[model samples]
Target: MNTRDWNETLRSLNVGLPDDVERLKAAGYYEEAIARIDAYLAEDWTKTQNSPYSQGLCPHMDVQPENPTPHGVDVLRDAMIAQREIMRRIPAEYTWSKADAIAEMQRRVKDFTPEEFEMLDRENRMDWRFVEGEKRYQNRFASTLIATHADLARRQIDPPAQPDSEKERCRRLHEKMAEQGSASARITLKASVGMSDEAFAAALAKAKAEGRDAVHVRAWLPLPAACLSQSDIELEEFTEEPTVIAPENAPQRTVCWEADLTENRSFGVQYSYRNTAVYTDPFDTPSAPEQPDFDTEEQPSHIVFTPYIKALAAQLTAGITDPMEKAKRIYDYVTLNVRYHYQPSYFIHESLPEHCARDRRGDCGIMSVTFITLCRAAGIPARWQSGLYVTPDEVGCHDWAMFYVAPKGWLYADCSFGASMARRGDETLRQHYFGNLDPDRMVANSVFAAPFTPPMLGFRADPCDNQTGEVEADGVGLYGDETVSSKELVQYIEE
Candidate 1:
């Protein structure tokens, strides 16, 4: 079959490699087929070998520009050889198992042409309404599951207890949820003014599935007196409002760290030949190699990031108490507890909880991801936001979390950096991180693993789950040293 036919077959089967490669091999173009495969493999080598942090003129190492790093080139070469071997072995035979296809197709997409990948992204992003709705859908999806899981985990730790009063019982449930790490969890009361039956169903289904560990009602939003009277569902009477915020009506903000030049001055103006390595963007995936389409029903991961910003949501209620106190509780836990590491250099389908279990440390993305996971686990709605940190002289990449805390709206939290500052004994960085943020940054985009509303014509160059930028035909910009300006942030900015 011709290339077109082969491509059609592969497309129909949802595989990444072209059918021509297989046919060519069977057609006895042994040398020619190997050569073709080698060419395809070459692309993989080029894309996969580069770290998001590689610096200097020739970011990919294929062509050296005026400024080149010896260390960077060495890494590029090593990755090139490694990926070349991986590409060489992709069987030309098209055995289309969904499980196998999902795995292998992801590989092919990663290796596919950047333009083609962009096109796929564009196709997915054509509908704006879908994209916005996905944000809301994502919010509900996270709240339901996280609440369920937290409740499950809580019940696993503490069974329901009989108390002297209904209020006591409610207090016991709240305490139980917190002990099991569901401190941020919330419950929907049927007496709420604007709550819908659909939301109630979703919450109920989730709680039942999780065995009802962390459940509560907004003080102003009273429990359906009828439902409470009928069922053994413990009732709690509160004279004062709960201090926590709910996810639905929270304010969201982005905090940028302004890079100053004083600290970035060259020490003795030194230059040395150092070897470096180029790694792909951690979120890069072959299947969705193009930019993401936020509007598409085809979410990148079935395992979505859930945000539990219930503390923020508490303020939205009419008769709520102590909003700031609740917010402080959340800010403290995330900023103090979660550790940040630079490992897990790539993104996968596993949720942040899974990542936390495996790698104790992660960079900003994973930290923000975990924040979302925890917030959702607590019944608070949260979402992702990432972009470049623009200072006077340099642009560095950053990621942080935003949660819906009703009265205050969607508030921004940068816990990863907050944790870092605390470790370094920088009280300013730690203090400014929790509720307030530094002013020297800009948000290029927000939302994690979310596709650009209007997809590009082809798939993205690296389309797993991340924010990306391109400086050259083949170079993929990543976090750390690979940043466009790198540490130069200190050189350009005055303040």
Candidate 2:
């Protein structure tokens, strides 16, 4: 629905719905009910502002939030998701006119190199134009953010990404899997953090004297979500017995332990799981799986359909028919065209895909959103899955896309990973991501904007999704406030 419809419906909501249908007699006054919602908790917040789901640029809106008791006000939350989506697609008004664009070059592009100007000209391609103040204006092209802005110069740099050898190996593995159905063994690995080696040794020595391994430490180890690619889930050992173990499929999978410092020398956990790669050739697939959520668009946020997105989709898939092929075209456009760069926090922007399209350079999450948005626009079912990218070397937050094609199941598209190979001119690796993904993934959050098992209070640090687990002590969230966290790949076992 359009933003206007959302606003009108929001303005005209029958806010008087009683908690129980039988209680309607006590809540018949619609105006008073709306006033109560608006003035809820003595705050005169607007409907968009009346949410705790998300903060900054997104609506904390769910059609039905998981409340133990049914609140009569949830109908309003559902409508607000639509309204918030409308707000996201609001055009980039007053960004820049032709004159302003030229002035921006003069100001930001030190020495105004002819080469840079030409690059900017190419990026513009007249994609961004909106009427502003009796004339049309153009937003500046993304070229201004060239690498290494120092000493009044912007030097270009090769795209930074996963190591070349590891990336190529992953692609080759997928190719082998696709051709021969050879499978990668699920790895049994260990993860841990926040303990000194010296302290650990001292505790371990004491535990050994007592014929034990526990040295006493507190640790939170990531627990993997149950996935077709992953199995044999186990948390073999810990410094202390786990006091908090998140559900197997929890949004941010974690198992926490607060063992006495003597119970275990190091705060750590050992677990093992296998990972199998998926490979598909789009043309070989004739249909999509009957998954419930993949068939629909994500809510009134980054993935929302708007006039701008709709037009862009039409332009991108002008003659595409086969769903798999259409999805491929979108993937090609992104991996082939978009530059990979670290982007600022996503919450600062109105829409992620729109931002990526306009700017042309963003990290994995941006590319994932862009791929998902365009694929959905082209009538393909695509969704998001992201978490830690655990290799033998490093573990860091990452995101990727899943487009469904029948017989092939859900195909993985790692545009960022593909873009990395494209930068190195590796055609095989670049194209592999369209229908395959390396098994080096910990799928923590399966869908974007999924709720936590136990809901959090206040705006979560990463409101849209959980990357690492979220933690709170004494009922106060620790993210973006007092606590910082990281995960390391202490071990990687490959068969």
In model 1, state the lDDT of residue 342. Answer: 40
Regions more than 4 Å wrong, model 2: 1-164, 188-222, 239-244, 256-269, 287-294
lDDT by residue (345-396, candidate 2, tens digit) is 3433447888777677677998998898888877778887787777766678
Q: What residue runs in model 1 are displaced by over 4 Å at the alpha carbon?
A: 1-330, 392-394, 426-428, 456-495
TM-score of 2: 0.60
Candidate 1 accuracy as lDDT: 0.35
Number of clashes recorded per candidate: 72, 21
Residue 339 lDDT in model 2? 80
How well is each residue in 1-495 modelled by candidate 1, as lDDT tens digits?
111111111111112234665465344344455566556545533333445424333445455333344233433333333332223322222123323323332443333344532453354311111221121011122122222233322433233353354223324433443344222111211111211334334444555576663222211111111110012222243222333321211121111111111111111110111111111111122222122222222212322322322333333232523333333455565566555544322321134444452444455776766666555544455666554343333345677766655444455667776776665566644654554333333333344543322221122222223333211101111222222222222222211
C-alpha TM-score for every candidate: 0.34, 0.60
